[model samples]
Target: MIVSGMSGSGKSVALNTLEDLGFYCVDNLPADLLPEFVRRVMRGEDRPEKLAVGLDVRSGGDLGVIPDVLSEVGGLGLDPKLLFFDAEDDVLLRRYADTRRRHPLSHLGLALADAIALERQALKPLRQIADVVLDTSALNVHKLRRLVITEFGLGEASTLSLLFESFAYRRGVPPDADFVFDARCLPNPHWDARLRPLSGRDKDVSDYLEAQPDVVQFAGEIAQFLDTWLPRLQSDTRSYVTVAFGCTGGRHRSVYLAERLARHARERGWAEVAVHHRELD
Candidate 1:
């Protein structure tokens, strides 16, 4: 496992969280030494079943070397996962002020904002390579820890955790979604003046949508498609899958369909189905 991100984006907190989850944790290992480090871990007299390493700008690591090293490790049959943490610039600035700590790049005589900008540029390569990019702008340490535990903890080891999310097509697709379904062709509730101010979760909006035969049929067909294929998908090594439903406004059709799918999955004995209404959030 590799943990990297912006300077104040909680890499240390992530490492501590992993340590609590029984992973052997290392901090600030140089990028050039990663290959040799992997070798040692694999062939050492005492090998840990799980290991996590932290890397950031302070490690004197060359960003250009990471892809090659990762390829080499992959050649050796290691399935390494990278986690990138990030936050909004203003949030990062606030964190630095609260902690009263100088930025790592401040030694170059750059201002705080400039230092942060430089760090972000330097870490862009790692961010592109990450399997998970966690945004921490609104998360406190405790919340982040809980999120890490929920995402990485082995409690649901045999089950595939499913996330059904609703989004607006105007906002583009969700980056992490495994399957994206378009609902713009469905009858929209936005045109209904009575339901204009209500969300899909509201009783009035739900009633309006439920009364539409086309909407009902769309939901049923999508649910059927998932039921037919989810088992095959679960047979793969992935632990989680995200199914996104998108409409023009995300206020009615998309949200209703996403909720309906979540319920269907649960009824089918999927114990870890979750619904996320992105626009609502």
Candidate 2:
């Protein structure tokens, strides 16, 4: 695994989490050295079963070379995954203030905000090619740790992991979603006085939406589409796919469909199904 991201966006936390999960972790590894490092490991008699190397702006090399290096590692018969971590500019600035740690590019005499912008621009290639781009703007250390462990720790490396997330359309779509389905057209439990305070996870809300013909048909079609295409995606070597459901308020229809699809995916024999309700999490 190659971990790279904006500074102060929890690369250390992610590396630490991977370490705890038995990954032989290396931090600040230069990009040019990556292929050689992988080669040495592959030749070792007692190589670690899992390895995670950290690379970022601090690593002091051309970030653009990472993709070619990744391809070279793949040519060596190892499937390499790049995970890029990121956060909002304000969040990163606040973190630097709270921690009083210098930004990696601080030596260039740029202001903190400018350094962040420059770093974001410099890391654009890595982010675009990343198998997963984790946005930690709203995540704390503990939440980030749990997310890493849940997504990476317990799954077979060869199997594709599915993430079903529910989010409010009003808050904008999740950036990491590979597929986003709008659930706003379905029957909403929010209008019912008795179910107003209840979320989609509640039996009352589920029963209300499940009774609607539109909801049932919508869900079935989405499931059918996924059933037809998900296996093909897995066969193409995708490590993770996030399917997001969005509604006016995340508490009702969106959550219902995310939960329903997650169950459906599991029933189809996909072992790594995880459900995350963004509004409720």
Candidate 1 residue 4 Cα shift, in angstroms, is 0.4
The residue ranges of model 1 lying beyond 4 angstroms of the native Cα positions read 155-281
- C-alpha displacement of 33 in model 1, angstroms? 0.5
lDDT of 2: 0.88
lDDT string for model 1 (212-236, tens) is 8888898889888999889988897
Model 2 clash pairs? none
* Count: clashes, candidate 1: 0
lDDT for model 1, please: 0.83
User: What TM-score would each prediction reach against the true structure?
Assistant: 0.55, 0.55
lDDT of 2 by residue, 1-281 (tens): 89989998989888877885679899998999999999998799989999999999988879899989899999988899999999999999987885568899999999999999999999999999999989999985545765776666553566677888898988789888899999988877888999999998999899999999999999999999999999999999887788999999898999999999999998999876677777775
Native-to-model Cα distance after best TM-score fit, residue 176 in candidate 1, in Å: 28
